[model samples]
Target: MMASPYLQCDSEQKLQCHWGLLLPPGCVVIQTSSSLTKMGCGSSIPKNCKVGGKGRKRHSIIEEVAVFVPTIRIPVDSDVVHPLRGLVSKELVDRLSKLRAHVVSLSEEIFLLTESRLEASVEFRWKTLDDDQECCVSSAWYEVLSVVHMLAMLALFEANLMLIPKDGQVGGERKVSEDAKKDVVDSLLKASGCLDYSVHHILVQIPAQVKKSFPCYLQEGMLEAISIQALAQCVEIQLGLASECEKATLSVKRRLACELVTYFSQAHYCLSGCDTSDSYGKKLLLFLKWKCMEAKAVAYYYHGLVLDKGAEASNHISAVCCLSAAEDLVTDSKRACLSFCLASPITRVPPPWGIMKNMHKKIPDAAYRKFQMYGYLFEQDKNSAHQSLPDLPEFALSLKPEGYELPSTDSIWDNVDSQPQIQSLKEHLNDEEDEVETK
Candidate 1:
């Protein structure tokens, strides 16, 4: 249950609009008293006007809201990633639902505001995990929709990490209670749902012309990796619970491990389409590889146990080989884990807490037992049969990531055309712009 250090937001766009002459004469801003509301301007910006050309500042009669986009930072040179606004966890889903609503409302507002060039585009700036600088995409409102969704999902995931229960010490006895695990499972599912929408739904809505140009954060491959990463973590947590249960069978544990391997390997494969040139990508690849290797260790160990129950000599030999492979994989994964921590923008690796932590205790002892069973046979038979690792049995995944649907367009958009004063305001603003440019 390790959390990525990449959290927080430095990507901000101050969104302010003067509505005195924009929206219909009586239109008032919908949001109030929150991050979105505090910045929402209900009238003219005070600094932009001075009473009788004196120094006194007061907001004019123009009703408006100041706008801001909280973009997450991508720290390449430093290891500081900040969380979005506050812990969005308490109201996160609602907050996210409102984000699309806000974007929809803003798009309509912008269209009315930009009477001059209906071609005016909103700039969406964000950064990928590996980059030092923020990336910008200016186009349709869906661009903003897509980026905001990514940030929301990321926030949800980071919050879920905070929710994970920690045992007092890192040891072989996995004693975390089932009740605690249940909550994290719910959070993980929500995170996966956001990720599911990011790649599958919202992404496709982005205009094709600007789609390919989006930063790695919005790209299909990276989104896929994050999505699967969430699922992998969920499966890991579930496996931890299963491992702790006395009633659980060997097959059930192996099934969970095999599924974990499925997610980690798929996530690693997604990285193939991404640009691994950046420090983040490189570090991520190492992490995925570590996870993949670790999953294999747990999977093979449980598989060896299941096979050991069979009656035939071949079964025993195969079980011995599986156990041996599991031991070697455990070693390999440890090395990979160290490499991940030592990568640039270095940070401490999370202490082993879940399945791998418990497996560490079991693999050596189990392998010892398997080898002990085979000792007499090797001594009795001069020519021992060659034993190579057998393929781990594949099991159908017990879990599937939930799908997400974007909220319907904000209700405010329904009355966009009904605002008669909007046209006159656009012409008025345009006329003012023309006078300044002409002068």
Candidate 2:
């Protein structure tokens, strides 16, 4: 058996070559051109028909079989094999040996553990936490393990790139090298695998910080970007070939909905910031106005909060506009579902002053429910404008549970429309009528 040139042979010779086995004799060759005449004798012939393995016939069936074989056997001399590549060369082998030594000396497991814990600390804002609070060191450890796994997968991917060949061409083989890595990523995501590595040496593992950094780094952003890229590439690959499912899944429906809600809230928050009469609020308000559109609920909610907080507070027009936009977006089933799922900073309702001013006539019911949702805010501590609204025209007092009770003279519900009634002296009339009926 011939030894590979890339491999060390059993013999004393450090270098070996396997050209004979690599491209054996009697191997047929065939070629086709863009514009061609009747190519001669496009048919099969005996193996021994020609001196150079290819028959005298211009085209042969055996040659076609050799060309069309599904198997790809990349030769050691291929570009992908090694940098200088006659085989795995002395330089590569030596380099690989050194790398192994270094890896062994440093210990990837320990390095990963230490690095991940430090990162997690930074991510979780552990340094800011009270020392008495027990830090979630486990998440930090897991993050470390996740990073290690990512590294291992990448290393294996590079290894496979050198080992696997898809077809005869060096290009084809190189293309498939990435497939292994993609598969590994896909597998990890599908499984939602957890890691056990740690970076406990660094900052505290605060929950909120940990949650934010974990996904953006570990897998979420990459997955999202890749998914979008795949959708685009697939469309370009086969023009007019999109299936119904693909079209729908890759559509902008969900994104549009999200953006619509996002902008309205930004507008509201921006306006509220302006009302604060402070540099911070003004700067934030102006920034938001420039950066965001008036289409998101979050913007509206935040603006309302800031406005209500500010000294020169009421921008009723802008506030109402923002709230209106937010309502429009969230009225839909999809947006409504998202509104429920995703918690926002400004979604908290403020205490009612007189009436819920931003409550739309069209969506009175939802507005009322929203008002009721934040009803507790009034109970916190209130006496005048900040107090719970009196049962006004919009919110009828008659419908309330306490409606049966008589109102005080100062109350709006007090009886000011009618005069006092007088009792009748009808005892003689009642007796005369009773006597006539009896007779």
Candidate 3:
């Protein structure tokens, strides 16, 4: 991958964006957009095929991870291969248990042991989402944990995408196996837990002086953008499960849809308040826009279904408007999705999986069927079709951030702490530090 301009801003405080794959201590990842056009579920949407709303399709989406390169006080000087982040993005399903163990080992034994949070004096730089041009720099070790956890979540997300069977048929969406659905759910929950740990356990502890240097991604709001969106996506998959069940009720479907809306809108609300000056942040916000609209559409469509059960003519009119709004939102969301994919560092939308895999086809068909049934409203102009639909009723959140805690500091630190040692900064930099000269 080509290097970023920010990589040169401070030669010693370098960065790399590759997910830390068996990362060496002295070097960091720069913002390199590894081409992802053909990888996992992140590939382009199939044509002419009706989609299941399993995934909100995108043309392309950028992925990022980071490593810091500097000659300053080193936080992690030992070679650390993060288990989750180190696992090949694909072929990781079998390794998840081991991956979890590694997460604790690396976090407590290696990462926390560095105590970069309290003692590091050198600047550490890391790239943020979606953008390769800018990076966040800090000396605090917690920033490393926050970013590493987020990056690991992305690594696991790919494994979930890979577990989903391919959708190649032109006429019908394939049935997702229960095993696949369970795996997806389990993986998503783990991913959410990773971010949960970062936001609550790691990011919260950053010293006040360190907080001011944070990028929007490191801030609570944008981190929520990542955290809650994972939950929303998880709920989207569950909604698909409900749709597949012959016994599931409209209320069940409606509840899931409402929950999806709440989760995505919560993420969007958090994203909107943060700075998006970077290219990655801008695309992320746009993608969240698409997600919010899609969830709203799904909720309205199901809500309209339940409302239509009532005998009142007013109920029928409102149902008509809800369906109308659903259709509009679907259209708007598609446009917004396109905008996200077309933004800088282009990416393809993953193939549809879950209910959304079929959602694209289902919504339009349902809306059309509902519209015909409610035709009399429009025929007599009972209410203007242009009138806004009712806002979605609020629902209690169905998903919560998986609880997470950093592993306790490794016993290795006990030995190191007992012995006192002194080393000159000059000697540390000259002998141990990987000092990079810009020239």
Residue-level lDDT for 19 in candidate 1:
16
Please write out the lDDT profile of model 3 over residues 1-439, one tens digit for every residue.
2221112322322222222322223111212122122223224223432122334353332432110100001112222212122222222312222322333222211232243332343233333322222333434354355444544444344434444335533333345567655655555565577667676766665676777776555666766677777788778878988988989999999999999988877878986677877664786677778778888888998998898899976678778788878888888888887787677655454455565566677778877887788778766764564345777777788788666544333233344342323446774465343333321
Model 2: how far is 117 from its true place, Å? Answer: 40
Cα lDDT tens digits for candidate 2, 333-381: 2333333223221121112111112323323343354445444554553
- Among these predictions, the greatest lDDT belongs to 1
Per-residue accuracy of model 1 over 1-439 as CA lDDT, tens digit each: 4323222112122222321112222111212112221222212123454312235454432221000111233211110111111211213223333432443333212111222222123343434322235556554333434433543443443434344333323222334456646655655565566667666655665567877776555567876776677778788888887887899999999999999999889988998978877665676688788889999999999988999898877778878889999999998988987787677655455557677666777898889898998856545654656366888888777666665443333333344432223235776577567657755
The ten-residue window of minimal lDDT in model 3 covers 65-74
TM-score of decoy 3: 0.66
TM-score of 1: 0.68
Which portions of model 2 miss their true places by more than 4 Å? 1-83, 86-91, 94-295, 309-314, 332-439
| CA error at residue 380 for candidate 3, angstroms | 5.9
